[model samples]
Target: MLKLKSPQKATMQITRWVSDLDWRLLLLIIPSLSVLVFLSLSSTPIDSFPSLRSFIFNHTLLTSNSPDFVNSLPSGVHNRRESSVAKWKDELLRSRMAVCLVGGARRFELTGPSIVENILQVYPNADLFLHSPMDRNAYKFSLLKMAPRLASVRIFNPKPLNETESQVRVLTAANSPNGIQGLLQYFNLVEGCLQMIETYQKRKNFTYDWIIRTRVDGYWNAPLGPENFIPGQYLVPPGSDYGGLNDRLGIGDLNTSKVALARLSLIPKLDSAGFHQLNSETSFKAQLTTQHVPYLTKRVPFCIVTDRRYGFPPSRFGVPVAALSSPGPLSGAKCRPCTAACQGRCVAGVMRSLYKGWSWTDWDNGSLELCNARDQWERGWEKIFDKVAGKKSASVRKKFADLKKKECVDDFNEMKKRVSNWEAPPPEELCGLGLAV
Candidate 1:
């Protein structure tokens, strides 16, 4: 109906229309092309993808230390990967380690030499950090003079800590001897050692690859092997879990250890997670899980040397005590050096009666022997300890029992000489902690 447009204008309009249509077509076609390419790539079998398979198997040693992981691999592949395994083990031995000892020196005379012999000397290069409360037993720590290296030692007089409302809501005093306050004190002891390690690292301008934390009251039956130093995971001894993970004897890389070692500092995080009425063990487990840290459990060759008594023929919730003579890596179970009260089928029957997660440990075969720890350590517990702990450890016990202030001062002085950080009271003050004024 209108005047006819020029041929050049009409041609230009047609050209613009064609360009828009081509772009719309491309939008529809490109996605389909991409889908087809993805389908084609995904159809290729993983076994045929040599580069992918090689990456998983080759880099595993740098990442994984789980024996379960190795066993899960193809049978023949494990044998071919032996060299990788050896290399990881070698790395563990050479890695810098911080061996942190925490708790009161209640049984330092008996436990100290074993720790020095099995843990400290076994990893002679590892620096030692000890944080303990000053008690009548504080003088016993003089045994640490035998330790090859002492990085830090803190012996402070303990005062009652003020409890927060969150601590009251989140913690339970059910099984603790000192109630919630007891747990707080123990937590402080552990966390304090971590603070010391941090200070030492800053002072020296170096980071430890691994941190090994154990109680001062623990008696080691064997050396802490290189296998326990998992690269990215926290290692804990199995069993004795009361609705949570074992809080005793933890080993890990510095990152994981930081979370594991912050026993007291992480309680607020637990409260935030809605954890209520948790005991130390449960609180400890909650701390790790809340922080998204991974942990693994293995049988460690140490037992807590406790003077506290537990019921024999333990009920569903009762604690089972072990005899030190048991040919075992007892894994931090409460133990005493005494004649076995239960063994063979007697042990099997009693152990079977107890809940595995609550109070029981792996006591299969003839590996475990029980103690009648109900009463005070039998009248002559010294001989029993000596007989089980051997002549060398026995001699150490005698030396501590007969310790003089002069000798204690001399011993601490010697230990101080080897230490890199001596953050403790003077040797004379430490030696005379329990002596009468």
Candidate 2:
């Protein structure tokens, strides 16, 4: 039926069939071959293959033994970063710094020498500007004669502040014992100092590179280190948020200082933002955020020295007063001189139980000691302060205690002479507040 093909013809047909099969196999394997070549030549690792990288790395890390893979990196990597930071901080030392000290010199005898020894002396080139409401205790501010560069001084009589409707509406009267009027007056005191700085800068035809806003009564256990002077950000102490920034201490360049110190002027802005029942700290934070300025917070080695009384083993919403002698940076925590009733584990448990957003600080590490602040500063607290404050600071306390009225007036006159601008009620009214003629 069919003629048989010749042997040669049959062989050629078989060869043709083999060639066609090879072509079909090549088509199927070419894609996989290309992918293999691409991966082999890639600059990135196999784990970074674009599609599976994130999923792969995450799963690998979870199954791995190491929890801190980044920190487990070589020490040299961290050391270089630290070295760069140190170099940057060294450059900040050359910038001009202005120390703007505000608030009353209520316990200047206790707080003054420390300021001189810590802040003013720490930055010998920085000029001192003191703005305080005149009080009987203000005579103690005469110790500022020790400051190397005294610039401006304004110790004025406290008069009622003319409150704007905005100020009344924005500020809260609850925590403020002096009521809404007291808030206005206090705001005037802080903002008034800012005005002094502005006027001084304009008169001199030069602006400060930095402005340090601090209270008169803050006790610093350490120096105002150059680390606080960040170039583009305002610096404030950490903790004690109290629904806002810790307004107790702030450091910034001139522009930031202007905004921060515009305490009274910013009230209208707060009102516009519909903020009410705002305390000092809350309002301070609002002003900065609304203005779009950046700020940074770190643990500072200073605390607000206080004479106000608080309940011992404070309940929630109660303030825990620290002892002055407690080894602390304090960081603006309320403190007074007294025999410590709580220390070690007692302080830790109390601080731990309290709200971190409210009156809490680094109380562990023996940095805090609790006082039975249910009463006034304990009798003979001065002796306790002297023993802890060291010799140089203690000598200052004695000098103020023994100063007579005429001597006080003479000292203030000398202070006035040193200051570039002097604004106050008068030398006699100043001396008569604290000294008996």
Candidate 3:
């Protein structure tokens, strides 16, 4: 098989091998040239390819339901939020609103101005109805003179309530330290304001489109917007459910509010429905549910400002009081001011341990700061509140703290002149409770 070939035959074979190698190389090069030509003709910029990939990657990262991602959203995302709020504001301008504020005015000096600016002034057409018990801190409410509209104001002395049989049977004294009498008084405060609204409506021959119920002790960091006004459903704040909807702040159409605000009148219905041992919030839910009323919840930008003390590093059943300066839409949770003992992972661990149906609030966004709250409000809290609440709000606080009895009486007189119904004690009695003789 190892036979030698002639020189001319070997030359011919080598040439054919060289020609086959060239054709194979051409086959590989032609496809690449075609691709390059196609790209060029399509006018695709070389830099644009990576940009397209980056855009998709960023969008996916942002849209994922990660808490961290949602908290630290991109700036463009904020623009979209601003746009939505603007739309909501426009709708609010068209609606007639009533704001019913209840509870004692313990910290109205700190809370009043913000309520005026963020709520009443924002809705200039809104009618404000105030129902509160007279107390040494009552003079602080003089700051409400800044409100754009005043419908009715009542500041009454605390009186012993005769708890009805139905109230005793339906309500629980377990969490209410003041017992059944406390529940009766609170129910009276809410329903009394509703009564004022009805009388005013009857006088004017026109009804409000919306009714808002909030607390006098509530400190609002932001304006209440129109998104809370659902046409068919009552709206309440999201957390501290206590086996029911949060009754600290509520908003609804007039029809829905009639059902929501009838606190005392609904007890008989609750009794018939076999609901018992219910706290305020639970009773509220029962009343609505039994009436076939629908409700929705959203996070509101306010806290139930408090001076009460709770234990530090709270137990599972204990309440976690937030710091006043904490950047939170506290949503009606109890709060006070102090150096924070918990945040981030510590907060998550503590919140997870607590009952969500009880004292829990939205703590994942780093918006909440915990306070030891083992003691009363610390010294120089005024300065701290002033710094965080801005100069305008601080000025309001200072004015009220320095309010004299005479000035307080004059302000009450002015408030009396403004309201259609002023069913309260005389200005002297109202202001004297707070002012030193």
Question: Of the pair 1 and 2, which is ahead by lDDT?
Answer: 1
Backbone clashes, each candidate: 0, 2, 0
- Give the C-alpha miss distance for residue 204 in model 1, angstroms: 0.4
> Candidate 1's residue-wise lDDT over 1-437, tens digit each?
12213322332333354345543354365465435433443645544333332223323443234455566656576775676666765776688889999999888889988999999998887899999998778888888888887899898889999999889999999989999999999999999999999999999999999899999999998888766766567889899988799998999889899999998888888888899999988998899999977676878899988899887777888787899988777899999888889999998888888888787787975878999888888878899899988999999888777778898889889988888877678888888876433
Off by over 4 Å in 2: 1-90
Worst 10 residues of 1 by lDDT: 1-10
* Every candidate's CA RMSD: 15.0, 17.9, 19.2
Per-residue CA lDDT of candidate 3, range 291-346, in tens? 97767677788998888888877778778898877777789889865667788888
Off by over 4 Å in 1: 1-89, 435-437
TM-score of each: 0.81, 0.80, 0.81
User: Cα lDDT of model 1 overall?
Assistant: 0.81
Model 2, backbone clash pairs (residues 3+ apart or across chains), number = 2
Model 3, residue 337: what's the lDDT? Answer: 54
